[model samples]
Target: MGRILMKGNEAIGEAAIRAGCLNYFAYPITPQSEVAEYLSRRMPEVGGVFLQGESEVAVGYMIFGAAGCGARVFTTSSSPGISLMSEALSYISGAECPAVFVNIMRGGPGLGGILPSQADYFQATKGGGHGDYRLLVMAPAGVQEAVEMVMKAFPLAEKYRNPVMILGDGLIGQMMEPVEFPDELKSEPSNNDDWATSGMETRKSSRRNLVKSLFLDSEQLEAHNRVLKAKYDRMRREEVRYEPYNLEADYKALIVSYGTMSRVCRTAVDILKVEGFEVGMVRPQTLFPFPEKAIEEAVRRESCKVAVSIEMSMGQMVEDVERSVRGRCPVEWFGKSGGDVPTPEEVIDAVKSFVKELI
Candidate 1:
C-alpha cells in the first residue's frame, strides 16, 4: 500500500480496521475522540459496528460484551475517562478476553489539564485496575509507532487473550506521520457465532461457551491468578522490547527513557557525542513487559556506570530503571509532570550532570 499522511488518532482507527478489529465501542475524550469519530465513519463501510455507549462506564462494558463473544473489539480514551473504565478493564483482563485500548495520555490526578503528559505510566503498565492483571501496554513515541503497534496489538491481544493498550501522549495522538496500511491485512473472525450469542439458532452444539471473570471461591481465584502469573512470567522473557543507540562506544553514563521523551533523549545523545561524553539510551517499546534485561545489559557495559531514567512524568519509569540496575549502578531521574515535555537541551543538561557526578 502507499504511504498515507495521517494524524495519529486517524491512523489508529484505520490501523484497527486494517488489523481486523470490527467491533468498536467508545466514549469521546480529548486527544483521542478523533479515534472514535474516525471509526464511526470507517467501521460502517467495512460492515463493522461502531457504538457510542451511554458513558465511559457503559463503553467499557460494551467492550466486554464484544470481546466475550470472541470478536475483535477496541476502545480509546484519555486519562480521566480511562480511570473510569479501569474497573471494567480489570474485569476484561480477568475474563481473559481479547481486546484493544488506546490511551492518549493527558495530565491527571483528577480532571487534570490535557496538553501532553505521561502521567498515566503507572496506571497503564502497573495495572491500575483492582486486580493482579497487566494489560500489554505499547508506548508509541512517534506516529509510525502509533500505527504499527495498533496493528501488532490485535494479534498480541488474541494470542494472550488479554487487553492490549496503545499508549500515546497528546502529541503523538494529534500529530501527523506517513503511515502505510499493509496490503496483506485480513478481516476479523466471523465464526465467533460459534461462541458468541448472536441468536443464530438451529445450531447443533450443546456445549455452551460462557466467558466470565468472576471467580468467587478463594482457592479457585488463587489458582486463576497463578495461571495468569505464569503467562506474565513467560511474557517477561519473550516480550521485552527496546531500542538502544550509541551502544558500542565507551560510555560514562546511559539514559533510559521511552515514548516522546526517548525521542528527545536520542537527540541529547547526538549533541553530547558532538562534544566528548560517551552516552547511550534504551527506549522501551513495550512498557508492561519492561526491557529489564536490556537495561541490565546496558548497565553492565564497560563504558557505562551511572544510568538516568527520564520520562514525561516524575520518576515513574525510574522505578523500573532502579529495579534493572539492582544497586549495581546509580540510577537517577529527571522529568516534568502535568502537560510538560522537556527539550533535547534539557535532557543533555541532565545527562551532563550525571557524567560530571561520575567524574
Candidate 2:
C-alpha cells in the first residue's frame, strides 16, 4: 500500500497483522491502547484472534499459552503493565517459547504517569523478570522504525526460541507519522510442527512435545542456562544493530540515546552543527545486545573528548553507556523524569557544558 499518515500505536498494530501474527492478547493501557483498539477491528476481519484480557497478568499467561503451542503471539503494554507481566515473561523465557512483546513505555516507578518515558530501559535490557534470561529488545525511534521492528520481532523470536520486545516511548505510540506497510510481511503461518505442542495425532510422531520451565535436577537446570547463554552470545555477535549520525567527520563529543530521545538528540546535533560544534550520535536499534562496540569506536576518536547520554528517564540508559565507554572518557547523563521529555535546547546545553569542561 501507499504511504499514509498513521499514529505510531496504530501502525504497530497493523504491522503485527501484516507480520503474520494472528494470536494477539493484551489489555488496554494508555499510550498503547490504540494498538488493541485498532487490532480489535482488524483481526477478526482477517480471521485472526484478538483478545482483551481482564488484566495485564491474565494477558501474560494467555501469551505464554499461545506461544507454547507454537503460534506467533504477542502483547502490548506500558511500564506498569509490563511489571505485572514480569512473572509470565520469566516463565516464557525459561520455557524457550517464541513470543513478542511491545512496550510503549510511560513514566514510572509505580503508576508513575501516562506520558512518554524511557524509564524501562533497565527492566527491558536487563532482566525485568527473574532468572538468567534476556529479551531481544529493539528500540525504535519513530513510527516507521516501530513498524519494521514489529515485523522483524516474530521471526527473531522463532529463530532464537526466545522473547523479542519492540521498545518504544509514548511519543512513538501516540504521535502521527507517515508509513508504508511492507507487502512482503503479509501474514503467513509459520511451520512449528517440529517442536510445537501440536497433538500427537497432528504430529504423527511417537514422542510428544512438552513445553515447561521446570527442572527438578540442578545439573539439568544449569545445562539449560548454558544453552540460553549461548543463544544470547550469538545474538550479541550477530544481531547488534545501531545507526550513526553526523559521524562522517571527526566530532568532539558523542551522544548515546535511543527510542524517541534519539530523535531529539539528532535535532540537537543539527542545532550544534549550525553553530560550528561537531557532535555525533550512536542510536542503538537493539537495546539488549547493546551496540557497545559502536559506542567505543565513536568515542575512540581523539577529538571526541566525552560522551553523554540524553534520555527521558533519570539516567537509566546511562549505565549501559558508561559500561560501553569503559572509562575511556568521562561519561555523563542529562535527563528528565516523570513524563518530562528533554528538549533539544536542553541537550544542546548539556553538550556545551561537556565541551566547556573538555576545554
Candidate 3:
C-alpha cells in the first residue's frame, strides 16, 4: 500500500488488522480511544471481531481468553486503563499467552490529565503487576514507527508466547503523519495445536489443551518463572534496538531518550551541532532490552565528558542510564512530568549546561 496520511491511533488499528490480528478487546480512554473507534468499524468489514469491554479489567481477560485459544488479540489504552489491566497482564504472562498492548501515556499518579507524559516508563520497563515477569516493551517516536511496531509486535509476541507493549506518549496518538501499511508485515496466525486451547475437534486430536497461570506447587511455579526469565534474558541479548544520532561526531555529552521525547532531543542535538557543540543521542527502540551496550559505548568516547537522560518524566529512565554508564562518566537527568512538554529549545539549553560544564 502507498503512504497515507493517518492519525497515530487509526494507524495502529489498521496495522493490527493488516498483521492478521482479528480479535480486539478494549475500553475507551483519552488519547487512545480513537484506536477502538477506528477498529470498531474496520474490524467488521474485515470479518474480524471488535468488542468494547465494560471496563479495562474485562478487556484484559478478554485478551487472555482469545490468546489462550491461539488467536491474535490486542488492545489499546492509556495510563489508568492499563493499570486496571495489570493483573490480567500478569496472568497472561504467567500462562505464557501471546498478546499485544498499546499504551498511549498521559500525565498522572492518579486520574492525572489527558495530556502527554512518559511517567509510565518505570511501570512498563520494570514490572507493573505482581510477580517477576517482564513485558517486551517497544517505544515509538512517531506515527510511522508506531504503525511499524504495532505490526511487528504480533510476531514477536508469538515468538516467545508472551505479551508485548508499544509505549507511546499522547502526542504520538493525537498527531497525524503519512504511513504505509507494509505487505511484508502482514502475518498469519500461529499454529497452536501444541499449546493453544484451540478446539480439539478442529485439530482432530483427543488431547486436551489446558491453559492456566495458577501453579499450586512451589517447584512448578519456580520452574515456570525460570523459563520466563530465560526468555527475558534472550530479549536483552537479541532484541536490544536503538538509533544513534550525532555520535559520528566527537561529542562532549551523550543524551539517552526515547519515544516522543527523543524527537525533541534529536532536534536539540542538531541545533547544538549548528552552535558548534557536538552532542550525541541514543534513541532506544525497545524499552525492556534497553540499549545498555550502546549507552556504554557512547559514554566511553574520550570526547564525551557526561551522559544525560532527557525524558518526559521527571527522572525515571535515569536509573537505567546510570546502570548502563556504570560510572564511566557522570549521568544526569532533565525533564518535566506534567502536561507541558519540554521544547527543543529547552532541551538545547539543558544540553548546553551539560556540555559547557566540561569546557
lDDT of 3 by residue, 1-359 (tens): 57899999999999999998989999999999999999999999999999999999999999999999999999999999999999999999999999999999999989999999999999998989999999999999999999999999999999999999999999999999999988999998777898899899989888999999998999998998899999999999998899999999999999999999999999888888898889899999999989999999999999999999999898999999999999999898999988888999999888888767867
| Candidate 3: C-alpha lDDT | 0.94
Tell me the tens digit of each residue's lDDT in model 2 across 1-359: 58999999999998998888888999999989999999999999999999999999999999999998888899999999999999999999999999999999998899889999999999998989999999999999999999999998888898899999989999999999999888775645567777789787887878879899999999999999999999999999999999999998688999999988999999999998998899999999999999999998899998999999988989888999999999999999998877878899999998899889879
List the pairs of residues colliding in candidate 1.
251-303
| Candidate 1: count of backbone clashes, pairs at least 3 residues apart or interchain | 1
Q: Which stretches of candidate 3 lie over 4 Å from their true place?
A: none
Query: By descending TM-score, how would the candidates be arranged?
Result: 3, 2, 1
Error of 3 at 257 (Å): 0.6
Overall lDDT per candidate, in order of appearance: 0.86, 0.92, 0.94
Weakest 10 consecutive residues of candidate 3 by summed lDDT: 350-359
Badly placed stretches (over 4 Å) of model 1 are 184-204
lDDT of candidate 1 over 72-135, digit per residue (tens): 8899999998998899999998988888999999888799887888989999999879999998
Q: Between 1 and 2, whose TM-score is larger?
A: 2
- Full candidate order by lDDT, most accurate first: 3, 2, 1
Error of 3 at 213 (Å): 1.2
- Model with the higher lDDT, candidate 1 or 2: 2
